[model samples]
Target: MINENVSIALVHYPAMDKEGKLIVTSFTTMDLHDIARPARAYEVRSFYIVQPIDAQRLVIKRQIDYWLSEEGRAANPTRYEIVQLVRLKYTLEEVVEDIERERGKKPILVGTDARKYHKTIGYAELKREIEDREREFLIVFGTGYGLPPDLMRTFEYILEPVYGAGDWNHLSVRNAVAIILDRLFSKNRC
Candidate 1:
């Protein structure tokens, strides 16, 4: 399954602030819930949340623990199932290492941003490559002002920025995940 070969990472560190300075952004509970729902729906193999801060990672771990508990399952079985897709990592390198361990091959790194990069690949072209290739893909998303240029350069391909009708390009990482997953995996896409 194509979806099974795809994974996503919501990166909070090495991101840019509004002024374009690199910073670590905090993750919200909503980000976990909203993004996981779509990822599970698409049957993505895994969803990694990358945060360098130990404190933030603990908070996320606690939440995940609850969601996986019997009480949490009783409270919301659907969410319990979805939450299982999430994996916490202290760095993007950790994410790559984990994926490589699980799949026995390094995933093709794809970055996401509101601004286009020189290596930007269109959705259609990316979809074709994903279908044609045998390797797994990890689509990395940045929070705050988006990923820093140095980090962006590490990716093999940066997906074309998602554009609406207007010039405003800012999109919540959760919303972008949902939209990108739909674009890449939806069975009824037009």
Candidate 2:
């Protein structure tokens, strides 16, 4: 994919079959399951793109600082190999590119704005980039702040951004997720 906006680290090859369309990098509305596992109250969303994202600055935290992963002594076993924690650290395109080098083959993506990782809605652009893979969506969210504005953009016809409650201007990934699940599973049909 030779997007003029793509990071310089990723080779801009013309070989990519799809281009010119919006490549979403966040979770889709269809991915909202009913928390079937129940082992964890909240599964921090992990962002992924099908195509190679030039996210050299996306600092993907490999450690878990949360109470469960850190201090908790309880048996937090998982049947699906759920990660202990998934954290996000946004930075300049250059920084995200660095992340790409650090996390090879693990899937690195690019960004456009810096909205502080607001919500999954902002991750639309990230999701579109890799929708064809048909993998499950687990968007690791930002801790202190939220995703930046540049990260969020709806996918093309193949997959568009999943919009939930709250306006785009001010929405948290956790809140967006809560709203999404509520609307998706809400039985109240008046």
Candidate 3:
């Protein structure tokens, strides 16, 4: 399973504000649902929501618990299935550790941002690498403005920005995840 070796992390902490200062952004209910839906649809191994704040983490946990409960499942079984793939974590390091523990090796960290880096792997090349399944891959997305430059530099591959016909490149992390997942995992690609 190509996608089984792939995972995603939505980092709320270590994110940049519009001014580019590092900050911990709050997670929204929409992010959980939107990202998890595509992740489950793509058969991603797991969806990680990384937040350092305890209160925020608690709120997210409650939502996850409710969606996975019998009543919640009865209300929306499809949502329950998507919520099952979500894993809450305090930091990105924990996400990596979790994957390392599960796979017995570290996953190749693939970062996504609106800005282009000096060296970025194209979607086609990454898709081929993912198809080969030589190792696990975890594509990381950031909330707020974006991930900090120092953090972005640490990733093994920062995927090329998803461009549009216009010059504006800003995209919601949820939308970015959906687009990147489609580009990498969709069977029918142009």
Candidate 4:
């Protein structure tokens, strides 16, 4: 079984650039639509969009509010429901505080990256841990080239990278979010 207490955080800043320099990344409209829909479908407790910049945070809030408003709901009821699951926070710390407030304790911070750095727990182990321990988790997805090593070091656990037969490992943050959520929460698990 999977845990319904799990949540997600899509980070926008302190990501890596092509040259591996730490930088702030902009959010795409597709990212807002794609990630939130799955988060709701998976029955996640909450979906957080963490942006350090005020303008970018406003953009995310507007998108979430618009999709959750009456007009947007009338246009697309399903998407509206999904957008309601989203929250826009200015920093990861804010997200932590929110989860603590909502769940009465801090969640386990699980970081996700496309590359393997430190020893990462396999998806199966993560799923088992969630089911057996019954603890809330805040799984973070990094944008741009991926989260900086320093940020990765802050996490208690880093999930294994999603890969296929080929050596190539590039995947959009939105797609990665959906894939990871499905693997962690899918009902067909043994």
**C-alpha local distance difference test of each model:** 0.92, 0.30, 0.93, 0.87
lDDT of 2 by residue, 118-137 (tens): 23233334435434433223
Please provide TM-scores, in order, for all candidate models, with all chains considered together. 0.97, 0.29, 0.98, 0.94
Which segments of candidate 1 are over 4 A away from where they belong? none
List model 1 lDDT by residue over 30-121, tens digit each: 99999999999888889999999999999999999999999999999999999999999999999999989988989999999999899999
Residue-by-residue lDDT tens digits, candidate 4, 1-190:
1345788999987789989999989978898889987888778888898899988878888888888889999999998888877888888999999998988879999999988867698998998888775678899999999999999999999999989789887999998998898898888766
RMSD of each: 1.0, 13.4, 0.9, 1.7
The per-candidate count of clashes, in order, stands at 0, 46, 0, 0
lDDT of 3 by residue, 42-102 (tens): 8899999999999999999999999999999999999999999999999899999999999
Return the lDDT, model 4, position 101.
Answer: 93
**The CA-based lDDT of model 1 is what?**
0.92
How does residue 103 of candidate 2 score in lDDT?
Answer: 40
Number of the top lDDT candidate: 3
Against the correct fold, how does model 2 do in TM-score? 0.29
Model 1, TM vs. native: 0.97
For candidate 2, the per-residue lDDT at 18 reads 30
TM-score for candidate 4, residues paired by index: 0.94
